[model samples]
Target: MKLRTFPQGVFLPHHKEDTAHLAIVRVPPPSRVVLPLSQHTGAPLKPLVQKGDTVKRGQKIADVDAFVAAPLHAPVSGKVAGIEDWAHPTLGRFQAIVIENDGSSEEFRYDPLPEDIESLEPESLRLFVREGGFVGLGGAAFPTHVKLSPPPDKPIDAFILNGAECEPYLTCDHRVMLERAEDMLLGLRIMVRACGAQRAYIGIEDNKKDCITHLTPLVRDLPFPTEVIPLKTKYPQGSEKHLILAILSREVPPGGLPLDVGVVVNNVQTAAALGRMAKEGIPLVERVITLSGDCLKKRGNFEVPLGMLLEDLVALCDGFTTPPRKVVMGGPMTGITQATLAVPVIKGTSGFLFFAQNVGKPEHSCIRCGRCVLHCPMRLLPYLLGRLAEEHLFEEAETNRVLDCVECGSCAYVCPAGIALVHLIKLAKFEVMRRRKRGGK
Candidate 1:
């Protein structure tokens, strides 16, 4: 059978053999955790507890009134040590609530939903998800409840479960699919009901044949029509837009979202987490992450507390086997490089990659190879956007639809000139968004 995929994507090494088959182990909480208030994309949360306040596992610690934000919950029983500035994986520094683990194993619980979750009202399910502090585990960290509640004018007909763990070396989703297939399916059903979708689909890359085979038979019993699609193993196949196109041949317009195309997409991990939340009466406190890289002594998938420090996680891996050059929080392609290990893993973190050798290369003038344009999944002119950005021509870049660039690093990976096309396009995108915010064209 011909596997489905979108056009203009590059296939790279999978780099997943090291830990792909490993089962997810639950790591104990560190001595302390740093919970950043701004982990989600929307408004930053305000601390609900001050210094010296004792909190239990699964306790809500910080939240805001914003509809687009997810609340923060304590992953372990602890005392609020302080609420102050700390190093963030993506943001340089942000106000974080530090908690010192007391190891009492005490927890706060919510009334778990009935076994037949579909019997519950959709609005009630959305409220439960919101209160549980669920977000997209697929890296965007957008609030999950918001996706469940689209505008009435835009009715959703299809929901896509993104099992395409296409990013190199990140196998947490793969492990989740294999180990927690039932929970993932349950979550998908809940999400489908909440979003009012008529049909559902699971898109897993062909590289993970085991996942497709494993999930195919299980989805047969779902209340709604659900199919497991084997996508062509391509980088960024897990991307929301691309996955939609691959599974349903739907195109999300420039600056538009899946809802515009009458669809919604979510990571398999996100669905599994929600399933667990409903079953276990727990919120989004801990998540599975891949802890593998060339420099680490140990490598495997782990269900780690949300705010566990990177340094502690490294220590659990028996420390590094070699001096590390670059540390990234998430898959290498779209992950953010970390300057220090002091930062804590947030809801959006998928994995930590440690490379022994520096991967930076000297930038050169674009030889006009046009490799970036050829491989750009969004079909944007990256070379033109990069040049326009370098010249500070934000208006022209925006006019050319530079904001559509997904920063998947396809252009950068294929660039012979090492021109940092993604970075330049990112800069242009930032400038364009800033100008629009300032009421400029």
Candidate 2:
């Protein structure tokens, strides 16, 4: 088979050596977990419990009436300490339910499902996913059910399972694929069945040689047409659009989605979570997180409960090798720099990265470098977009297709002058969307 890849992406030095070989260790549930009501991409969830209300593990503590919303479940059997504004991993600040663990692991009984899930209807499978509160564990945090059930007119013909941990220093997905191959496949099978697609492809980067070796034989006997694809290891190869382009040679139009192109893409962990949810009746309460970088003493992949504080993770990792100048959530290129350690990990927390002060190049003025334009996966002129954004010309940036930018940081990575092209483009995109939402030009 010819190994395929998308064009114009930069080669990333995957800083996954530390945790790639380490077995995933189960993180003991914290004494108290802070469950954010807005862990996902849609509308915030409403608190379902009041102060002094006792809750059990796997009990739905918060929910919303919105179709796009994904509910939150209790990670441990505990009492509702309070519902108050708390620091969130991505949202900065949001209301969260504080639960004090009482040492009892009592769980609410899960409703039994049909013995043979393959025989169930797609709508039935979708309902199960929605009730289980599944979301994209690959960092976007979009509700999984919404993605699973696309509009009827836009029929899905293919399903792509993303196993490319292309982001630097993140290996949680890699570890998940190796350890939970069966579970991942189980989820992938359901996802394939749910999306009304008969063919599914699982894409893993070439760097994860062991994963390819482990998964190749499993698909041989699959009931549906499932193919294991070995992708070129490159930055942003895991992005839905790029993955679609590489695997199927199809282009998802600008300002569109994988669904628009007759394809449904998902993370490897997301599939695993779905498999676990359907099989074990567990909702999205915890996830695997990769903690690795030059500034950490202990580094490995861990299965941590949602809403555990970053400070707790730091402590669990034995603190940093030196006082980290920066701590980021996710990968170094696309991850956001954390402002405070008080924030709790949410459903989308993929990895925690720490870096010493001396690590990267300092920013400088753009020196007419066209590298950003040349390497952009979307083929948008990032340098021009950055210039327009710097001038606060949001309309101009949008006209130049700034909204098409995937924000992969490839331009910034390759820029000889160290221009913060991605940052400026993000600012422009934010302003553009804000204006568009308000009916402004």
Candidate 3:
């Protein structure tokens, strides 16, 4: 069978074999955790506890009234050591609530879901999602409840479960699909009910043959109709717009979302988290993350606490085999590079990658060969956008739809001239968003 895929995506080395077969292990809880309120994309949550306050595992620690925000919970029983500015993996520095482990994983009961969820309304399902502190585990950490609740005007007819895990050197989703297929299906059904979607599909890349083989049979018994789609292994195949096009052949307009095309997409890990939250009463305190690269001797996937420090992971993995060159929070294609080891993992963290040797090549002038344009999944003119941004022509870049760039680094990765096309585009995107916020056209 011809596998489905979006057009014009670049092929990657995958780099997932080292940890692909490994089972998800639970990391020993760290001595300390720093729960940042800014884990989600919306407004940062307000701290509900102060210094010296006692907290229990699965206890709600912080939240906000913003509809777009997701609540945060404590990962382990502890005392609030401090609530102050601290280093963040993605946000640089943010106000974080630091907790010192009390040695007793003091328990709070999380009641299991009722015998059935069919009796629940969409709003009720979203409430459960928010109560569990769920977000997109695929990274970006967009509040799951918000995604589940779309505008009434734009009804979602299809739900796509993103099992693609297309980014290289990351296999947590693959492991989740293979190991927790039942839970993932349960979560998908819940999400489908919440979104009022009539049809569902799980899209996995062809590279993960094991996941497809494992999930196919389990997906048969879902409450709603669902099919597993084996996708062509392509860069950014897991992204929302791309997956929607691959599965449904639908196009979400520029600056629009998947919902605009009568669809909603959620990651496999996100679905599993929701399912676990419902069935086992497991709050979203811990997440399965991949820690693998050529730099480390111990490479595998593990269930890491939400706020565990990077230093703890390094120590648990027995540290690096050689001097670390670059550490990233996600996959190389779209992950953020970390400058410090003091930062804690947040809700959206899927992998922590370390490379022994610096992979960067020297930057060069654009040769106008247009490899970036040819391979770009979004089909934006990256060369012109890069040049316009480099020349400080923000208006021209915006006019050319530079804001549509997903910052996937595809342009830069395929550039023969080694031009930092994504960097320039990122700068332009930032300025464009800033100017728009200031009421500029």
Candidate 4:
């Protein structure tokens, strides 16, 4: 297939061979798990259970009064050790519920599955999803219910399932597409009903021909209109904006969203979870995580609980061949580096990558090269944003569309001078957004 052209993007070494072929493995729960109070994008849930309290598997441990946030459940039967501050892999330090495992892999008692799945209403189905604690497993961690509940004024026309696992070194979604085809399709039906859309499309990158081959046949007899488009394999092709453009040829304008174009995008895993939740009433307790890197002895995907630590997960993957110099949660491009291995994996963690000391350092300066601008998918001036940000000209940076940068690090990757353009632009964008929010007050 001929590759589709986007405004700006860079081709980096995928490094996905380390684990892409491996089937998903289940990691044994660690001795203790640190469940963060806040995992989704909205407000943090309040702890419902305190220290010394025993919680059963699938029991609600933390919940928020807000509708925008999903409730959190215990992944295992355990006693709450205490509530304390712990290192969050993405959000830094935050209050977390530490639970010591009781060693019983007990399943929670819930209603048995009904033989007929078509009896439920769309609103009831959405409530079930919210109650089940599901979030976007594709790493944005937005509450799924909120996304389903688009405003009445904005009528949705098409629902897009993002099967584009474009990130390097992570293939959990690919595996899900290949292995969980039925569940994904059923979930799509539910999502179509929830969003009140007439048709749905599954956008998969051409790199995974196997997935396309597997899913195309299964979706043939579906009630709703379903089409699977083989997208051009490119870095950040899985991003919401780019995916919209690739499949539908619609541009999500500056400071706009996929919804603005009457489209709703959901990850395959999220849909699979919804399918399981609607029928089985199971909550989002565990998910598939890709654990791979150069320094690790074992590299593959693992089905792990939300609160497990990196050390325990790495140990299960046969431990590291050499002591890891740095550990990052998720794919290398968009994933954040952890300050310590002790940080627990939250709902958004798609992969845990370990690197040795040989990895290259960040670039020192920009050579005024236009490579960043040329490769940026957003088509914003990353080099100029970096300069404006560095000089503390926050207003100029905003005017130059710093906030529009997706932080995909395309500029940093293409920079011959090794300038940390992405990092500087991100800092400036943050400051600008903060100032704007403050000024509104």
- Alpha-carbon RMSD of each model: 1.0, 1.3, 1.1, 1.9
Q: Estimate each model's TM-score.
A: 0.98, 0.98, 0.98, 0.95
Best-matching candidate per lDDT? 1
Enumerate residue pairs that collide in model 4: 8-375, 363-418
Report the lDDT tens digits of candidate 4 across residue range 1-441: 544535568776777777778888778888899999989999899999999999988888899889889999898898999999999988889999999999987666445334344455768767777887888999999998888887888888989999888888898998888777877777888777877787888998887889888888888887878888888778788899998888888998899878888899989998887776656766888888888888899888888888998888877877889888888888888889888889898999898888887456655666676888888999888888989989999998888888888888888878888888888998998899899989951
What is the per-residue lDDT of model 1 for residues 7-46, given as tens digits with 9 covering 90 to 100?
A: 9989999899999989999997788999999998899999
Expressed as tens digits, the lDDT of each residue in 55-139 for candidate 2 is 9889998989999989889988989999989988777788999999898979874675554667889898888888888889999
Clashes of each: 0, 0, 0, 2
Regarding TM-score, does 1 or 2 come out ahead?
1
What's the CA error at residue 33 for candidate 2, in Å? 0.4
- Please list the residue runs of candidate 3 whose C-alpha ends up more than 4 Å from where it truly belongs after superposition: none
Candidate achieving higher lDDT, 1 or 4: 1
Sliding window of 10 residues with minimal summed lDDT for model 3: 107-116
Rank candidates, lDDT, best first. 1, 3, 2, 4
Judge candidate 3 at residue 346 and give its lDDT.
Answer: 93
Task: Compose the digit string of candidate 3's lDDT tens values, residues 1-441.
Answer: 579998997998989989999999999899899999899889889999999999999999999989989999999898999998999889889999999998795866577767577667988888889888889999989988888888999999999999999899999999999988878888887898899999999999999998888888887877778899999999889889899999999989998988898998989999998888888887899999999888887999999988999989989999989968899999988899899999899999999999877677777787889899899999999999999998999999999999899888888888988888899999999999999999966
Off by over 4 Å in 1: none
